[model samples]
Target: MNMREKTTKAENTPADKVEIAVRLDSELLEQIQHLTNDPSKVIEVAIRQWLRGEILRDDELTRTPVRTPVPPRGEWND
Candidate 1:
């Protein structure tokens, strides 16, 4: 392996990543960085779960005809 490959930061990055920028308060930002090695992955999982719940809730409503709220994360579908 060449030195360039060893030094590259994109080694584990997905090929299709959407660039986004957020401004975080200093304390919360530091807490996340210090507590989690991969904050991006944590955020990604959270978003995916939220989207999944929405989709599931929509399908459920169509079949049941009741205005029930979607179960919180890690509840109905884990």
Candidate 2:
């Protein structure tokens, strides 16, 4: 309806959001920005890594291994 509302909305709107909050130290935040050139990009990269790890972990859990259990030594009937 007004310029102020439009400006506020534009600034507040996130491209995508997860309803969560995370806190980081100022030094850490600065470090991430320095390393990635964008703080948000660092967060995005971290989220991607975390998701990938979950996928790998799930895959390992669901994969079937072909291995027979070994019994005690010298227990075979001649």
Best-fitting candidate, measured by TM-score?
Answer: 2
Please list the C-alpha lDDT of all candidates, in the order they appear: 0.71, 0.72
Cα lDDT of model 1 overall?
0.71
**Predicted candidate 1 versus true structure: per-residue lDDT over 26-77, tens digit per residue:** 8877788786887777667868889887435565666856587988888975
What is residue 34's positional error in candidate 1, in angstroms?
5.1
The number of the candidate with the highest lDDT is 2
Question: What are the clash counts of all predictions, listed in order?
Answer: 0, 0
The reply for model 1, stretches above 4 Å from the true place, is 1-12, 54-78
Which residue pairs in candidate 1 collide?
none
Question: Roughly what TM-score does model 2 have, to 2 decimal places?
Answer: 0.43
lDDT of 1 at 39: 76
- Tell me each candidate's RMSD, in Å, in order: 14.7, 7.2
**lDDT over C-alpha atoms for residue 50 of model 1:** 91
* Model 1, residue 68: C-alpha shift (Å): 20
